[model samples]
Target: MIAQKAGGEATLLPTPAILERLETKRAIEGDRTVSGVVQRARGAAAYLYSAGVADTSSVHVDSGYLTPDDMRSLVEKGAVGDVIGRYITAEGTIADPELDARTLGLGLDELRDAAMSILVIGGEAKHPIAHAIVQHGLCSVLVTDEHTARSLLDAAPDSTTSGEDPS
Candidate 1:
């Protein structure tokens, strides 16, 4: 809806209802070979391929939260957040490792194939994860506010921070 308002067409994926059905099927059957699962996966992969994602130069990923605390919470107390069974953390780390395979969406390999991986996140709560993303080169480009950018620069390694040579 927002993108449409801005003149960029939005491509919506499967509805939650349809996704739930596929999830249920996956939980019961364990493989995509089962009747409907294969078709849907192929359809989605085909859609992505047709959408120019295969070119690696046009695919842009805009989701995933960067909060190490969220990962810690899920690990320490089984506490779930925005990443419970839905979102993938930076660099394809699953917030809920227990539900790793059950994640029904684009594979990390496909995402890594993209020429530009932009991570747009900010604020104190997310600083740690954002820094981690930069340190690990999880995102090719970052879009964030000034305060967070300074924080990241301060936390960055001498070689990575501005005004320092990589040698």
Candidate 2:
């Protein structure tokens, strides 16, 4: 499970507090693994190490604010040897590892084909962004507050009862 921040002028980064809140919500909703990218590389490294999953590597994209030393500390802590430090142009797009891998010339589709789940936290303005992510097949599920969920559900196509077709 990898976490990537939502890109925009708002500077969205899933901090430890946000992750904790999301985890708690997931637990209540009967989910096990829930995580997201953090602003600090050290945080990302810590998260990956704590997860204890084999063959899994965590990435912390360069935010341009953190220094190479900071990134090195994160790497020393066990973040994946591969680190991404570049600007993504898409505003509402979720960071897909596959896309990241492609940009680095890795020539591997493991990250690209990997199934990713994103947790989006925001109000109405973020709805379209979330929708766009879903449309792009980047996120499998979206975890949001009740209000946002209601709004999305309301906007979604209505379904009829089984065996009853609405013509």
lDDT of 1 by residue, 1-167 (tens): 65468564445333221132445736645443443443454343221121111111212212222234434454353222222123334433545544445445444444344465666666666565566556654556677889989998787667745876677
lDDT for 165 in candidate 2 is 82
Q: Which stretches of candidate 1 lie over 4 Å from their true place?
A: 5-7, 17-92, 160-167
Tens digit of per-residue lDDT, candidate 2, span 49-106: 1110101122332333334554455334433222122212123222333323223211
Worst 10 residues of 2 by lDDT: 45-54
Error of 1 at 14 (Å): 2.5
Pairs that collide in candidate 1 are none
* Candidate 2 residue spans exceeding 4 A from truth: 1-112, 161-167
Candidate number achieving the greatest TM-score relative to the actual structure: 1
- Each candidate: RMSD: 10.2, 16.5
* Cα-based lDDT for every prediction: 0.44, 0.34
For all candidates, the clash counts are 0, 2
